[model samples]
Target: MKSSFVFLCISATLAVLTITSAAPGRGNANATIPANRTQNGTVTCAGLNDQKKALEGFIAAFVAILFFGSNFVPVKKIDTGDGVFFQWIMCMGIWLCALVTQLVLSFHPNNNNNLNQTVPVPFEPEALLGGFLWATGNMFCVPVIKCLGLGLGMLIWGTVNCLGGWASGRFGLFGVEASLPGNEAENFSGVALCLLGVIMFVFVKSEGKKTKSNETDDERAHLLFSKKIQAETESTTLKDMSKASDDLDDSWVDRLNPKVKKIVGTVMAIAAGLLFGVSFDPVTHLEQSNCHNPQNGLDYAFSHFCGILLTSTSYLIIYCFIKKNKPQVIGEAILPGLLVGVMWAIAYGAWFIANANLTQTISYPIVATAPGLVSALWGIFIFAEIRGVKNLVFFSFACALIIGGSVLTALSKS
Candidate 1:
């Protein structure tokens, strides 16, 4: 009975995400690939670069959506198994294997040349702190799933995660503490307002001054004619674009209008955390079922492998394309990703072990709420994702509603 209501709430929350930017390509965050500007009015069949990129996008999104959507079901299915250790080991192993493969391939092509070496930057304490908050939050998520069921955990963590994200957008980091209490009734009201503010930011379109497209062509012809007279072998386009990529270097990362960045990043992160919170449920269920056939325990390992593979592969593909200098970023991302992965693995693995020893209704909530509250504090003080004085008041109001709702929901379980 408790599970059903929790599931219902989660479903409602997911519906909201789907309606508001969850489905993809509906907002600015998803870079708009203009269809009308395609070559010959059709997607030109290009070499591997463009084709690979296009296919990768589709595959990555497909895997991600599937991975997130099925998390609850898998956890539920595996509720009866003693195989938690094996399942988790294989899942983490799968991701590690993938990472190893990337490293091997990167260095294998040029054993002597250091062309692909990463530029070392001093470890920034702020980035590490941000990563720690994420790792800790992820560690807490597993029990949250078990206890709060899917919906309420999503609500609590999702909101707090948003606060962390907003901080990242504003201050380029996520662990500051907000002075406001999250448990006041007024805090709940902020949820609706926050949602509205997010929609406004995401959906609002801005136009840059339009320019004539052909002006460049005429200029190009004149330059080419001049080049021919000078007997130069090069085209001017090559010269103009030689220093193009670094053009944005002059701008500060915080140049993104701090207030707007804070709001948008917070909203995006919150939505992402909410979606991610619900993503692992399916795998949890699959492991719990222990419905291993005559084929053996390989079924459990294989199924778990499938889920992790989908997630890790999808992430790699997406990050590779979206962050063009991915080779450089790989060093930065891997350690953090591992930290997050292990934290997440421990949380979910522990939940499975506990579920095996105790009833689903009793053990899950305890673990879930522990991180629920901890993450809130981390977001406020550590990440400082919350905004102004008014936001502090709003945060307090939302926190109250969240606490009241959580209490009421928990009490209703009896």
Candidate 2:
């Protein structure tokens, strides 16, 4: 027990360090934005805008890290004893409340029937995949937390998730495991090795441009000469090319190439997975912390409300900043956010019930591994991410390590 407490302390310290180290770098990343804005009072408007952007990035990253990191600190306070049912009730209430708030805020009071105007939902494949993956991940994690304990479960889960994220980006499953034995530590090791393999597979540069996948030496020479020749020939072609670029930028998904598109998809998948993995810990924490008082339901309620609001709102804000001049984009953002909110509430709620029927050590590893398998399968079949004999060999070794890690972690009595 004392050792467990010590481990927890170390984990907490590490979490803090990760956040601290990342924050300032993100802030400085926006330094160039200040040069473009107009001046105001004493401060340059550009500088102010840059500062705001930096601050927003910090807040977004901080909340994201908190959401992801919360898994280690299970809600040991407010169990409510009703298990999954309680989780359901809480989630349902939160969803309803959020929906109502969204409706109210989105509506304009002065115009006739304006407030009642329905939001037109887009055909968003990414949102669909995200919600489904997240829901599945949540269901799986209850079992993992039961088996693995909060700290180690989250660690391996996070580690595998990181690799799964990379695979989903380049050419792997969305968030599923491709193939590995049911062992947790080995599974994670597999994911790590797979990550290494992927690193070997792709040639990345500091600017994210140069790659081993480029044309041969002669082809490069020809391309460079052609570019110079084209530049000398006509300014009109340059203008036309710039116009074409603008048009491509207008469509939301057009900006994404296969590689970037996969990354975006994978990011959405992992966001859902992370949510699923951490779902039960908060409930468990709440149960342990607030079992003595009935009215303290508000504590758990407020915390979850904050969680949902933080995630959805940050997503909206970030999207707006990324795609400036498209304020109407918020209309399209509604459904996906709403879908995620609903799915999130339900997944977490259901797992809380599942936890009542099992031990955390038994439950968590299974949960963590399920989406991993799903992601791997998606990579192989749906996305056709893996190929060639050498790649396959590397993939197999990675799978073995992932399984070994999972087994070690799950069987840990510590």
Candidate 3:
């Protein structure tokens, strides 16, 4: 126990050091950014250096996609007590990760940024609203993953998230100005193709809901028993463990029928996507609402993370009361939670950087497609979530649609 605590402290210190390492040289990066602006009011690359900004945007999109796809990997390691408890710790980690960006951008000299003169904005706390909304939406993630499997779950939510976020930036939803790429029709086409890809995957038939034919009830019970023993230390026979398991399966989520599980999973995934669509709402709101110093870029990252922490905490508090002050506390969640938080922070950091350098129309679609691809890959190869030649064929076609759509979206900006 002490060792885990010590490890977490060291990891956190490293996170700070890693983020701060780039602080002094931020100007080096700022030098690369183009001074781009849209007449509609969103901040993106100035038309002056189109090729350069596109390249930078693509890079940021790549990073965001990779990290976002893998952020939940740590949660798979330990059994989260009630998921809410796990989510709370995960959000705490996310907040800590957000601090890295907040510190770097807050303390760094912004005068040197190439876009400074054009954008002329300062950090705004309104970004907190974006984070808060996102946190509220994110609470459904664990359940979604459990229900849909990573591939279908991520694909559905990611595709929908792409639609919402891109539409918001494209048409200026919720007070944000529209982001017009050079080719509006082509941009819409890309989003449509991605949507098509999601539809294809929907029919791909992931055999995830099927229980293993070989595993008997006794074996399943033993595995659960062993996990509990490892998580907290208990020595008992299989019969005793089986008895304990019968009494503990009380949550409605645990009692879901397979068909209901599929339906609920799909619904939860859609909810997650809708939430993701608006996760950045507050930041956009600041730019559109013309709040004080109405800045764009990484400056909003800190407050956004704080919003996540705040919203998540509120949920946990409500949950405590709902469960009669018996919140399921997962002790093993700390280090993994921190790691996952950093992963998301890094991904979001890259996303903010992409927002600064790329057209929202292009960046959003490209980013949205790739993470679903990544998660699908993990599901297929790592978790055996999908198999059989028919499924593989559909998977290939779906991937083609996603990749093709992402390319189309990126080209729309060009």
Candidate 4:
């Protein structure tokens, strides 16, 4: 009942936001406005438009933070063995959600004229690069969770991801146009505060459930004996044993030394953060470059999702081959993986909208670090993962810093 209620609430909230965001004159460039004249007889809708866009951008950012922080909750208790297969399934869900979004935008009233002529949105293949980068980063999620726990791992990577993404847009790295806010000092301070908040998150210890090694000697022995009984011939038994051996080898990460494992996990988290931080580069490039004649950021959704699905599928195929057709496939993880993917897709879509309306400079810091606040709330209230006065104090301070930073960043845009 609790899960159902939460799901309904989330659905209703998303629906409301969708309607509010899609309201006429929200972000429509060709929106017709009433000509309210100022004392000097100049049209005064520009200020109103800017204010509306800013409001929409912040709303979209809030949605992004909420969904991104909670997307993995569905799979928290499910065993996603090895993660590769699960990721591919998740990408399928992402693609499906994007397809739905594409259809909605393609048929939007804005795209139709008085005669009902529909204007088609072109698919930009360059947007696929962003999806590829995101999928690559996502491949490390399971390992990071296993090694550092979700809270610590998310904090470390979230900090890096926030900084890298904000810097790229602020400075116009990778061919994106530089986004300079009205108040540079305030913007910089806001980002610094957000970073400090993320760092503080790393210090607040959580008592979440820990993962254990799946491989056991008894299980291997049982598999060997089972294979022997199922075999009709000695050659078949040998092949079965070989497959079993390959299955055991698939858990090589579990066999690493504890110190080495932590190091590997940290490296993977950093790498993922870098990849995630730059995942929007392709879209930003397409929008800014004259070559692509960029459309709305949402127009690239389908192609971007296509890229993610294709890349994840390729990785799964490679993993299957490496495992000698013995890949660890978790039967129960499929639905949860799909649900997580859908949630992620919605969050990412909102992120694209936020970037379009607010620019990455203002959106990056808030979108990236604010999710930590949402996740912390979940840990404290829902999962009971965080306890004790010290941790609560840290959480409170971190929330204050993050909220203040976001407010400053938004003000800087003015």
Clashes of each: 54, 77, 2, 0
Error of 4 at 229 (Å): 17
- Encode model 1's per-residue lDDT on 256-288: one tens digit a residue: 665665454444445446443333233333323
Candidate 1: lDDT of 214? 42
Q: Report lDDT per candidate.
A: 0.35, 0.38, 0.71, 0.79
Candidate 1 backbone overlaps, count: 54
lDDT of 1 at 313: 47
Give the TM-score ranking, best first. 4, 3, 2, 1
Tell me the tens digit of each residue's lDDT in model 4 across 1-414. Answer: 368537934773474358335433212445535554677976578667767867778777888898888887777667687889999998998998888777776665443245344445568889999899989998887788788777777877787799889989999888888999989999999999998888889779877543355644456556776776566355567777676555545366677889998898899889889889988989888777754353467777788989999899999999989877878889988977887788888888888888878989999999999888888788888778888899999988999999999999989997
Error of 3 at 271 (Å): 3.6
Error of 2 at 234 (Å): 20
Which residue ranges in model 4 land beyond 4 Å of their true spot? 1-43, 111-115, 147-149, 208-250, 291-294
TM-score of every model versus the real structure: 0.32, 0.33, 0.76, 0.84
Best by TM-score: 4
Tens digits of per-residue lDDT for model 3, 88-144: 887888888776556556555554445343222244567878887788778887777
Query: RMSD to the native, candidate 4?
Result: 5.5
Better of 3 and 4 by TM-score: 4
Instruction: Note the residue pairs that clash in candidate 4.
Output: none
Give me the candidate number with maximum lDDT. Answer: 4
